[model samples]
Target: MSDNPKPTVEGGSDLPGWEWDRTVEDSEAVAVGDSVTFSKDITDDDVVRFAEASGDTNPLHLEDDYAAETRFGGRIAHGMLVGGLISAALARFPGTVVYLSQDFEFKGPVRIGDRATAEVEVADTLDGGRYQLSTQVLVDDEVVIDGEAIVLIDEAP
Candidate 1:
């Protein structure tokens, strides 16, 4: 599946009221140990929108009452939402990138209103225009999600 040029994503958000802090484009170069990042402020609005889109209405991610009784103590954001930030970071790559695979471990919960940063560094390279990246999402200096991804880069059309 990683070998395929196109994945299933059809578009990105152009919704009003939400904004990215920074947009990095046309970087110097991508080499081993180089990195890319994208950060966003997680809001209740973001959580609700994700739930509606993903059909993951687990109370742990929605109702405050239900989540307060659980280990998380309050409504928490979806783990995959954080992963999407990692995808956002990867999209900043110099060229078009198609995610081949991702391995993730959810180490901690992301509470509403928390600011999360996704950092991905080039760990190594494989044959046939592939790169292996070390991926991590941090919330206030704590590692919340960690993983690695294999991506295939295509020259821009």
Candidate 2:
């Protein structure tokens, strides 16, 4: 748990229209306070793209009528699609981060158009250039995904 205030991003996106902001230096020594995060609004285009790429065409994610009959009562984004937000946050780490392992719990639904944020905080630094992090995704103030990850980081080649 860190008391550091969250960082903010200014104008400009690496990818047009997709806002990505990172405020950490990779060369900086790892510390418990270290963290990174990014956010984007989930869109119908996003869902369609993910569904097509992942081949996870479950009606809950692709068919509104089908989903409406379920507990969700409407279409919801794929849990993995939402989890990718966590990977997006991890990519912001100060070095080249390679995912070694991750654990997730899908606690809630992320609807299309909901602005989602992926946040990761350094919880422990292991020997051999590895780090354990607390991972989470949120829609507004609600925690939709909770998880942890272990990553191997190396200086950019």
After superposition, which runs of candidate 2 have C-alpha atoms over 4 Å from their true positions?
1-13, 20-23
Residue 43 shift from truth in candidate 2, angstroms: 0.8
Whole-model Cα lDDT per candidate?
Answer: 0.78, 0.81
lDDT (10s digit) by residue, model 1, range 1-157:
0221222233744233222322324333456777777677788988999999999999899998899999878998999998898897787676778999999899999999898888888899787888899999999999999999998877666
Error of 1 at 153 (Å): 1.2
The C-alpha local distance difference test score for the whole of candidate 2 amounts to 0.81
TM-score of each: 0.83, 0.87
lDDT leader: 2
What's the CA error at residue 150 for candidate 1, in Å?
Answer: 0.3
**For candidate 2, lDDT tens digit of each residue in 30-147?**
6676888778889899999999999999999999889999998899999999999888887766667899999999989999989998888889988898889899999988999999
